[model samples]
Target: PDFSHRLAEYAAALSTRLVDLRRTLAEQRPDTYLPDLATSLNNQSVRLAALGQTEQALQAITEAVDLYRTLAEQRPDTYLPDLATSLNNQ
Candidate 1:
């Protein structure tokens, strides 16, 4: 339980860092960073859900799903599965 709690905290921090990274990188390098942001968001959602932060979990997953949709549109073979996974998490 302690390990789970620690991991959840780490995930939340990682999510925040990814958002900050996106702000810095998205305009210039979306293809490089957006998927990382999406994955981070998805993980954040799962962690938030596990911690019983329902509204935050939904928000994170919704953002992830949106990013995944755009990524999937560009590279279906690579990102479609990720989109499906994020949707399943949602």
Candidate 2:
């Protein structure tokens, strides 16, 4: 139990760093990096959920869902499934 908690904590920290990096990249080249940022956010949500941080998890997934929604509008074929996944995650 202790090891699992520690692992979750470490994962959450790593996910936060990854999200920050992806967010910056996305800002620099939105067309190319938005999907990456969304993916990172989705992954971060999962890690946060594992740590039992429900509110933070919800916030991360909500942002991911919004990002996926915008992407889906551009390419539903590719992003609708992701949007659905993010919604489910939320």
Candidate 3:
């Protein structure tokens, strides 16, 4: 129980950070490092789900999958694997 609680807290914190990073990037240079951030968010979602934060995990991964899909469309060779992983996770 304690471990799961800690994991949920960590996932929430990480999700908040990712949101901040995305907002900052959008305000400063909208096209920069989005794919990388999305990948991080996807990984965080996986952690959240493992911790049993189902709704939050689904929301996070949904956003990540959308971003990955867009990235994969632009650069299939580079982002297809990431997109595939995110899809499988979802």
Sort all candidates by lDDT, best to worst.
2, 1, 3
Model 1: residue 50 alpha-carbon error in angstroms: 1.2
Q: Cα deviation in Å at residue 75, candidate 1?
A: 0.8
lDDT of each: 0.86, 0.95, 0.81
The clash count for each model shown is: 0, 0, 0
| Residue-wise C-alpha lDDT for candidate 2, range 8-84, written one tens digit per residue | 89989999999999999999999999999999999999999888898999999999999999999999999999999
Query: Where does model 1 exceed 4 Å of error?
Result: 1-7
Better of 1 and 2 by TM-score: 2
Number of the predicted model whose lDDT against the real structure is largest: 2
Runs with alpha carbons beyond 4 Å of true place in candidate 2: none
In model 2, residue pairs whose N, Cα or C atoms come closer than 3 Å (at least 3 residues apart or on different chains), thus clashing, are none
Alpha-carbon error at 74 in model 3, in Å? 0.7
The better-scoring model by lDDT among 2 and 3 is 2
* Backbone steric clashes in candidate 1, count: 0
